[model samples]
Target: MTRPLLSLTNVTVAAGRAATAKPVLDGVSLSLAPREIVGVVGASGSGKTVLSKAVVNWLEPPLTMRSGEVLFEGRDIYALRGADMRILRQRISYVGANPMGALDPTLPVGAQIVEKMRAVVPGTSRRTAERRIIELLDAVRIPSARNRFHDYPAQFSGGMMQRALIVDALVTNPVLLVADNVTQPLDVTVAAQVIRLMKELTTTFDTAVLFVSSSLPVAREACSRILVMDEGRIVEEQSTDDLVERPVYPYTRELIRQTPKIWGETVSTSRHDDQREVVLSLRDASQSYKVRKKTGFGGVNLVRAVRNVAFDIRRGDSFAIVGESGCGKSTLMRLLCRLELPSSGQILCAGRDIATLKGRSLLEFRGKLQMVLQDPFGSLPPRTAVGKMLEGPLRTHGWRVEARIRERVLKVMGEVGLPTELYEQLPLGLSAGQRQRINVARALVLEPEILIMDETLSALDQAEQFKLLDLFEKLQKEYDLTYIFISHDLAMVRKACNRVAVMYLGEVFELADNERLFFDPGHPYTKALLSAMPTLEPRRYRPEECLLEGEPPSPLDIPAGCSFRSRCPQAVDKCSRLQPSLTVRERQDFAACHLVLPPTASGGIGGVGTTVP
Candidate 1:
């Protein structure tokens, strides 16, 4: 048998001083063979991240390796010093969760990677390093690798930034790679692409990978062997299939249970009712901005963030808008909330154009349509108490009685699952789920008719998400609230949303009921998204046939014909010269594709044929 490439023998990691320290990783032992992929999965505070950091000796400050040994190629890495330590670091690479903060913002992204390369391998020339970095960038499927070399970190999309970080990790040809929740911040399609790239690179580079994530499905997609962690202990370890199918521990089974299913048995009931009133409507709405060029010279490019988008959200409907990063989901959310008026066309709220509202009318509109932003902690004022934070919205709308305000605040807090005891406490050190509940309570305090949730559940673990979703369902039924969910999580959408709209490059590619969109999608883009969704069930759409290549074109330089044609697998000659308009393909189901023939034109609604179960 081959010797393990990396080994941790009874490792114990702790945080804080020796007397009062708490063990974050308790007696964890694991081994990794060359070219093997291992996954460590658990909930938020279960020590998954701590284990990854311990493996790479990246732990600092209060985090200390209290005992045991970490052996790389049969040698203890902790004892290495000076030049030996440098060599060990060169043999291992660590990629973190947040990509935007990974690189230096003041320097070019590629240049920073090249600098690291030169440092690790001394005597390397700049020209030689640049050529290799660009090659790795191309190998990672970064579009226009040569041109993007000069671009700063801010210019790259979230997916592109992540791929760039991978390039940085793999540039040195390390023997081991530590990836800590690297795909949590990406869209489903982009995350799938990154997972595939990592698998390919593991074979290509003969490197072992330690994939740590809070999401089991994502880890199962990338790793061969799995370890389940809970409360700083490895509760179970087994092959990926066995662990998922036959979990031995109760914690492991609960983790699997909490993972949202895409195509499994669902409890969602059809809630669409045509007689329902139209709470919000968008009529040919479009938004644009002038952005500066990459060159220092004075020049600007027109970025059409949203273009002629049309949709009607009915009362008490859970509507969803989904797409990959840079596909204009945020821009659409801003328009719907009236934070930014559309450049052209109208956004109607209860048959009244929101653009024409002013003064009291605008304030009333704001109260009627409240928004719950994505970042739970960042959205809250850190220093303010939860009670005061909730009261601000009430006071802004002319509530003078403090007694009544306190009564209302406590009532809303209880409705959102926040304990009344937390009213006097700051948001500091609260769990992500609790912080998010505060955000929800703040929105609910306004007694809004519509609530727009922009990736509200993306930052949470699966268990928290599952609980919060249940809470949302109860609240919606009790309050008769209409929810607008802007997210890339298809599983959550599958469970919660009644109507769905698939967006791509500032255009809605398909609009249909959730059942039709998942079972019989009408457009190629929507199919690709469904295919890329991570799930444990047998996939209806095979990813090999439906997954897209590279990334979508920049909004500033969108393709002339179909905005999505550049990445569409079934694009034909007609798609290059004429753009398809959103038209009905079936009963009330709309698709923007020339290939999709309406039911009247064909024997049935046919485009890209339906998936086989």
Candidate 2:
């Protein structure tokens, strides 16, 4: 019976001139009550972003509002002008996907937010603004809010920057907030915390929210009601529980089906074989960098990126390394492929120390171990044709004849599911999935035994990811290839990887087969990550019990003892005095936690945490 805080009726948005406009949002209608959270779910190019931008009238040129009425407090927002429009705009805030680009690089993040606050609120003293900003920052769970306020945007991590952006959006105490894919770039734990924070803040501030995301599970976590968008139209709308349990539209059903499951039936069969030859191995390998301090002093800080990492990849194994951002997954990937020599220890490729190799030996190592980098578009050369791009690796490795090179390039392209017709086409207008396939083809052209996929599928949508995963499975079987996946996508890992290594603060917390790690993890951090993962199935680990608080300690100043103990909930007295080494918890499972008792003990397995039905 309460009046809706915002309403859109028969809203239609289109691109280009009137004579040749194409619809982006077709007859979309929705209403948000006070303090209510509504979600819009769809795949890429589904017009979800357009609808969010339309709510705040932030759409630019080429995006024309064809027909619609957007009402704020029962008043037509489009009819308002000048001061009225400015005031209305101030009452609605939008937070986008990229928090790093939102704040000015030249100014302290807090100063930029305060500047906006004064501009909109008017007559607010600097001291009062600072107090309010810091309060909101703390409310969003940024540790040492006062100290971090003076830190530059570059100083804050991805999760911290996102929380700061939320603080900026809420500083005005708007009646409505439009969050567009804000959590897409964050880690699972960080995303869960942000979602929980938004729920609490919506109640505290009595503000409605329009949560837009490509991920259905993420939307389900934060919203009461969901709207499924497809090709600029609202295909279906229902309560979150009812919609997820029984969807009405085909697209919605497909979206639900495409969402990777974590606790469901195993998708990838066991491919682990200890008898197989070890393709790659690491022995106490470590890496670090000396970064200069921001104070213009001559002193520098040592960033311990990777420390004492030990792992082995057998032929035909699908191994994964998963952790939050800055957890040394990337550094380990570099070490595995010999991009950088380890500061200490050894990285052995086929029983030969990679760091000791030079000239022809190094070239041979490069040929044997190829890498497919992240950022599909950025990794590819825009001007180069797809065929030529794929051929470069083959040419570098000595495929002399042009005819033979073209033949090999086309064959690799087919293996990655790229059409032959695209061989001569430039990568400029190609889709992200297509560009990534080219990268995969480029790596595969080398006929390498080991392939390191560094967040290779993160840029893709659910459907594209599924297709690529299937392709990888086929290639693995045919080529006898070994895969090293470095990613934050636990769902994909759950479905695709055979073995997993959980890392935290540059240390491997747990390593085990996929089933054991997912079903019965020994380390608390692994449990926390599983709990924080967004999935449709009922959670195995309760978030309230397992979710970590705040962020990991800075790599530059890692704590003594256990690096994870600072945020760990079950830390004991001994955890502060001594660090636990990787102890065998089961036949092949290893965990570095003080609380986990060895299987020989009466406590069968993982007595540290409880699970939910």
**Which has the greatest TM-score?**
1
Across residues 1-613, which tens digit of lDDT does each residue of candidate 1 receive? 9999999999998887585688998999999999999999999889988899888888888898889999999989999999998888789999999899899999999999999999988888999999999999999999999999999999899999999999999888998999999999899999999999889878898878999988999988999999999999999999999998999999999988888777777647455578899999999999999998877898999999998999999999999999999988999999998889999999999899999999999999999998888787789999999999999999999999999999999999999889998989999989888999999999999899999999999888899999999999999999899999999999999999999999998889899988889988888899999999888888999999999989888888888888888888888888899989986866568999988866666655443332212
Give candidate 1's root-mean-square deviation (CA, Å). Answer: 2.2
Q: lDDT of all predictions, in order shown? A: 0.90, 0.89
lDDT of 1: 0.90
- Residue pairs in candidate 1 whose N, alpha carbon or C atoms collide under 3 angstroms: none
lDDT of 2 by residue, 423-498 (tens): 8999987888888999999999989999999989877778788899999999998998989999888998998999
Q: Which stretches of model 2 miss by more than 4 angstroms?
A: 18-20, 294-297, 600-613
